[model samples]
Target: MKAGREKARGAWQLSLPLMLMITAASVGPGVARADAQDLPIPCANFEITYAAKPGEVIAPTDIETNKDSFWVFENSGGNLACGGTGPFTCAGLTVTVPEKDVVHPSTAKTTINGTAAALGEQDQFSLTSIDANDVTQTCKGTYLFHVSSNGGGWGDPHLTTVDGLHYDFQSAGEFTALRDDRLEIQTRQTAVPTAKIPITNEHTGIKHCVAVYTALATRVGSSRVTLQPNPNVEESRKGMELRVNGKLVTLTDSGITLKASSGEQGASIGPAAVGGIDGHIKKAADGAIEIVDARGTQVVVTPQFWNGPNVWYLNLKVYQTSATQGTMGIVPEGSWIPALPDGSSLGPKPESIDERYEQLYEKFADAWRVTDATSLFDYASGTNTATFTLDEWPYNSPESCDVPGQTPVQPTTEAVAQAACAAVQDPKEKADCVFDVMITGHEGFGKSYQIMQAFKPIGTGTWYSPEARPTKPPTHQGGWVELLKKWWWLILLLIVGLLLLLRKKK
Candidate 1:
């Protein structure tokens, strides 16, 4: 209405002589008087053109883009222009979103006055110039989201990632676990400093700190779900509370379901059934919540009990599409901007644990850390990420120790840990559990590692045949040796044949 009134008001401002001149000129070949204003406005049909610039660089086909913001449609160039360049204007440029698109401003009616506004798998829209006599111009386009196919977990008390990369992030704060165009996961870690109780590691003397997730939140489309510790703290420790979009939700025998709007459901949450919500869900063995979005993105928010700290911290297992882009997702393949001091690429993978730690913990970790503007986790009335983010690690190295409130870790020897973790099925996990148990000096934590080993991810979410990445690294040991051992007789026959040939020649 404002744009129409502005155009009408301008049309009336025309002088009598000028109006007459326009009318006389309009009698020519094809020009016409347009509009129902007090005075006729001379113009022709309004025209619109599409441009990718001044907005997201759309995919070659205008379907895939990795952004959480809406797409922008530029119109200052030609959209709603009368006579191609006439003094015509339009406003209240609205867009029609398909139900499949769970876009922000998740409303049916969306307005994008040219240089602003966009959404979803596909959109159909129509708008007219401000002139009351102008015809409505219709437009339509399709967009399919691209996603990341790889995801991994951030283990409590023990930092781990998909790259088989591990480190100790002993900082208490919320960090962006994963984020993509359509999904996001965030974690709240609590740091445990070794300044209380007896030394946990008798061998190392225990001076370092470790962090663990205490709260986890995820956003798929517009449905935000959070699993955090129950406020009612007890010596026995109550389980976690699940909230959807800030409203506390309870789990039924069949679990809970949430949607972006009143349309088709956007996500389904349920208990860890024998088969999992039709295999779309991946429930944690410890009864953590498993969520599946329409796009088949899987998220498992789990809590682990830390006997050493006598606290329960959370962990995250994310299986995003190829479109995933956060630190926990399939990030860039070890490409660091500031080259090594000698000016060389960091190679495709880290060569050593220190190199990997520097890349993941220092460089890549900082790259994806959330700021106030981009953070998706809901904060309490008076707190934020900054409130929790501090010098979480203040103690010096164990080389020289000053004891304070170090938590007591159960004593466990290497043999004991191996035997405890022997029940774990996966050899890799068994080794890892044994290693971790030795480090923490507690056999109980072996259960945590066992659960970690069994963390079944929703591999390549929804991908019937995913793109081929590098093959798995060669096994720690084996390859030809095992094959040869199984075929010793065959080898012996070849050796005997060679000896017979040599004897015949002699």
Candidate 2:
């Protein structure tokens, strides 16, 4: 019985060590595996370069104003042809008026100094036809105007007629006050021309025929004038009014219409006149007046004035389709169009891609340093796995362990990675660049490996990751090898015990 007991004890000791070794090799350490929480989150502190499309304007293109006065001219249908014939043509007329001082609160008149010239190919008529001789002449003159308030109304009555060598004209007008320091004027006038020629008859040796020609020299519609306050002049708000005639008119960006009003009219002049007696009024950038006619002809009126308190002097330049005339009127200049509020400028500018990549890499590094799982996932690819690899096992070195109160050293060099990403032009490709991070310092015994986290672009210089990290504990060092190394003495004991039992049996 004693011999049998000794043999059994030796057999049990040999098998026990082998059993423990097999068990240790099959099962791993108790610690949990490194999860996404252990991974480094990519930062987004990067800049991005963007390109603008062609003709992309960042500022406004039109002029805008809140207040101003305008001298608008509406055309009245009148045939001013010299002689009624086929292909009717009229001589172009230009007038220049010198500035005059206004005499207020009195019966005294202000005299206008100016000259008038008749132009175009139709002004050469100097012939004698039996009873009458026709002569073409240029007339120059001055206008005397007086302002009186007689309680009933205010009138700018003419003190003297516009009398020249061959023409005599008189006008009566009233000024109506409007809101915001504005005034409207309506005027009516009549002109007559007299020509004397020598006639020889059969009965009389020599005779004179006096021909008095009558024409309607009247302004049919009203004109508006606003007081433009000059910043340089104290309490100086002075302007003039204008009246022009046309059949149909429209206002366009390029120019105005003076014959038949057509095209797009941005704003309305007044009630539309039937049978093509309409006109358009537009304000230019320099406070000039643009008038268009039905035939697409334009007349630009620019005003010049001395803005003095109580009294003002005004001069005007009227530019026709091809000709320009200097006269007397008021022009409101310096109005601009409103612009949209975008940061873009009028032209294109350059942006840097390398700088943007550097910023992005820095952001990623920051997130990784904190081990922020959420931020890491957000900046990584949604479809690909966020992989992690370790050069050495966990707890192999003090720096590799996740100990309390210890910051982990980042494994990857951010500058090198960022440089690589900067070469990629495509946004998606840049975002998908591999995030190879190495974990340096961890306290726990859990093993960690190198990481390759996938990322995708989420637009507007952002990236996202979607894969979950592993949660199971890593196998301790070497699977079966480690187990055998730890329990090799047990195997030797088993071999010795088996040899002793065999010897006893022999």
List per-candidate RMSD values in Å.
29.3, 47.1
Overall lDDT per candidate, in order of appearance: 0.44, 0.23
lDDT by residue for model 1 (189-265), tens? 66544322222322123335455577877776556777776544563265667777788777655556554532222
Q: Pick the candidate with the highest TM-score.
A: 1
lDDT of 2 by residue, 292-365 (tens): 32211222333333211122221111221111110011111220110111211112111343332222122211
lDDT of 1 at 405: 59
Residue runs of model 1 more than 4 Å from their true location after superposition: 1-148, 154-170, 194-208, 261-285, 331-366, 392-411, 452-506
User: Where is model 2 poorest over a 10-residue stretch in terms of lDDT?
Assistant: 149-158
Clashes of each: 17, 56
TM-scores for the candidates? 0.49, 0.16
